[model samples]
Target: MLVRPHRSRAVTAAVAAGAAALVGFSSPTATAAPVPGTTVATTTTAVAAPVTAQADILDRVRAVPGVTKVTEATAPEGYRFFLIDFTQYRDQRHPKEGTFTQRLSLLHKSDDRPMVMYTSGYGLSTRASRSEPTQIVDGNQLSMEYRFFNTSIPTTPDWDEELTIWQAATDQHRIIEAFKSIYTENWLTTGGSKGGMTATYHRRFYPKDVSGTIPYVAPNDVVDGQDVYDEFLANVGNDASCRDALTAVQRRALGTDRQWFLDRLAQLTKEEKLTWTITGGMEQAFEAAVVDYYFAFWQYSLQSDCADVPDAATATNEQLWEHLDAVAGMSFYADQTLSNYVPYYYQAAYQMGSPEPYEDRIADLLKYPGFNTAESFVPSALRPVVDDTKAMPDVDRWVRLRSTEMLYVYGSNDPWSAEPFTCGREASAERRECYRFYVDGGNHGAKIAQLPAPERTFATQKVLEWAGLTDADPVAKKVKKNGRWSTNNQLDRPEIRGRALGRR
Candidate 1:
């Protein structure tokens, strides 16, 4: 959901000025003044220039202690980008234990402009040049790569003691404090899926760090058995025919045509030059793919063009294979994909809850009925100790008691949406700032911009108003009618999409 800036300076300036006006800040006007010593000499001062904002913010960011590196990055037009690495403590409370250098990307629009902090729950592949939330808020963007993901891993890792959600939230707090020294404006935090979950966790731990939070498709808690996911699968799509068609496809792939699909999968594996670290080998991986197919079908392909799964009885091998590969391919469950998700699994197993796969529907067709656990999806080498519930209890309490000025967007059809944060009846009556919008018949790809008419307009206005931006009602009206809000096309690819089973 990263955006590349290609805006003209005139547009950037106008937007910045408008944002300032909305937030009750008046931009200083540049005017020439006569010098005191010289009768004819004069000097002009430009207030809030983009160049000054960039230089001042960069200098201040570099000066933050533990910042090991700051390299200039090529960014979209009208913006300055930098890749930064900061030495952070593995245990922030006990700073003497050890340290790890975490990576973050800073996309500076202006020092006086509002800031959008995108919390990436996993390793960031690239600096999200632009994102839906950033566009709606129209501010400076900071994309943080979660610790232990990508190049942010610790020197001597202690997963049991260090990879807690509180530690991750602490990392975000430190970054926000450092950057607040320069930006000095209202800050908004956001992320999608796990990233969205990270945003919620940060707000729970450090509520005052940011002005508002907008978490997209973020689940609040992970149930040990993931019964909610089972409930979600029981009812996902809008049409019964579509759901039945999907069920038929699942049955065909895992039942009558099981061997054929497996052979085709093997051939596809060879053709694609795939490899995996899965313990159950190709057959096991195939089973996982079968299980994944059900989730992926509803999560991504529930759209019109993809939902009409062909009748399995009349479908050719090629047709089935094409649909299967496109929907839930072996590459998704391959070793490479599994390897990158060890940190997520650790978090899920230890503190963050995981959802269990719904096997009752297709149990008769499953090759390994016992493969219901999420642990099967993780690489065996990086097994997690599932005894600790870390910060789940605290986060739960915070959401129930203190969460405010928060906007949560979720899709009605998304499995993750099943466990959205629910405000208690008393809180719902008392809390006006907190809102959750469930897009009707929407899937995982849903965003505030993509929501239909009045809802879309309502969400836009709410978020902008929450971010302290002025003219939100007017802008929301225009954007809603014209479809101007940024859309989130990049979807999360978690190794285990649903709840993890077999909790010890």
Candidate 2:
């Protein structure tokens, strides 16, 4: 249960860098690994003659408008992967305003097969890999980079005007619409964390685009912060000792052991040959790291590890540093890490809300309370971007009243679970089409395969029906295998979601 997901290395690289968010059946053993490709011009090879199925797919990829480049990438058996570049607008409202090449990765099976479109929250690594939904549904996958991220940057960057959630969803709508002419079968959208939220936003704006959506650990966040996370942290690990031990570690690391932690940061930076570029110096970065530790401890660790966390005051520097590094990466706050995640911060500040810092828990320990760590990293000119309070609430309302064929998954230990998309409806009802499941001991990389076996079977069956692939071999093979899987995670059954606050 040790998930070393330090900023996913570079956004959610499709099943490949997912190589962070990519899933391989069970457990959160995913990380984003970088893949290389070029943005060359592309044109459609008209499908006048019906050739082999593989050849026809290439023609369809070319036929899709705005597709500038398509190059083959390594893939697992039975799948052909292509890295694509599509020239998209700075703002969908104004066609002539400008354009930038957005990254797209397609994993093809056949025209008649269902397709799963991944809504990534970060830059697209464009590598070939299937998400949880794609794997279970056994469908082709299309992974697109979010607008203004990595290679998808706007020609004229304007975070305030161009980087809104609606604009990003429109980018998705454009791609999905273009692909509709070829793949007439079922369609589904899925992603984890920020990517999961991206999928939900796409559904909110264009619900009918896909037959269903499966968002793992996605949050429909808003405004300054949500108190749900604070409560989660307070009770994380489901053991009072585990929760107290975590905060105690933070206190010692930031208080009496402050200098020791600083020295370790400097030494590790030099050892790794990395540079620091956070607004505040390494000290402030240290402070941020300690504060984020409350989350990292549970989001990345397991109940077993909680017993191993060194006593902040009693353990040797080596013991403390080992546990710290295991939970949080040393180079997470590095220059390149910040550069890649700057877009995430901008979106969080402008539209997608982030969890407020654990101020009540560690306010006095902080050296820079007024300075928002990630939000402050945004350019000074972009400061004072008003919170879009309506953004999340509108989606939440639509999800409850109008949303259908949607599924949500969360890990009870994941801090992001604090503010899950909450429209409490059951699947047993005829009208309700949404369902949520929690991985017993899962972390941020939770998967449906990890859900308590009964839930896992039910979820996959629902997913198969939704994708119109009812004939797929879900129950025929895995019934005996799932029975042996453990059900209990040794933690209190914390509620998976809370009332996502509006402006708290």
Error of 2 at 309 (Å): 1.5
TM-score of model number 2: 0.82
lDDT of 2: 0.66
- Give lDDT tens digits, candidate 1, residues 1-504: 110001111212222222221121111221122211111211212222223334665555665545555777777666788887666776777776656667788888777667899965765534436656777866788888787664466545666677778889999998888777677878999987778888988988899898888888777663455447777778777677777777777788888778897787677678766665554587777776667677767665445844467787788867977776666654455553444455666677667776666676788877687573556755555564665654666676777767877788888877777778764445545453677888777766568866877777777766676666675444455665675654333422232222111111
TM value for model 1? 0.80
Tens-place lDDT digits, model 2, residues 1-504: 001124422223332232111111111321111111212333433335434435656766765666666777777667778888776777778766656667788988777778899865765654466676776666788888877655466534667788887998998988888777667888899887777888888989988888889988876664446546667777777688877888887777778778888888888778766555534466666666666666776775677878787887688877877766555544565554554555676667767777766656677887887454446655444566677778877887777777788888988887777777775555446776887888876777678888877888888777777888654444323533453222222211322221111111
TM-scores of all candidate predictions against the true structure: 0.80, 0.82
lDDT of 1 at 493: 28
The candidate that achieves the highest lDDT relative to the unseen native structure:
2
Q: lDDT of each prediction vs. the true structure? A: 0.64, 0.66
lDDT of 1: 0.64
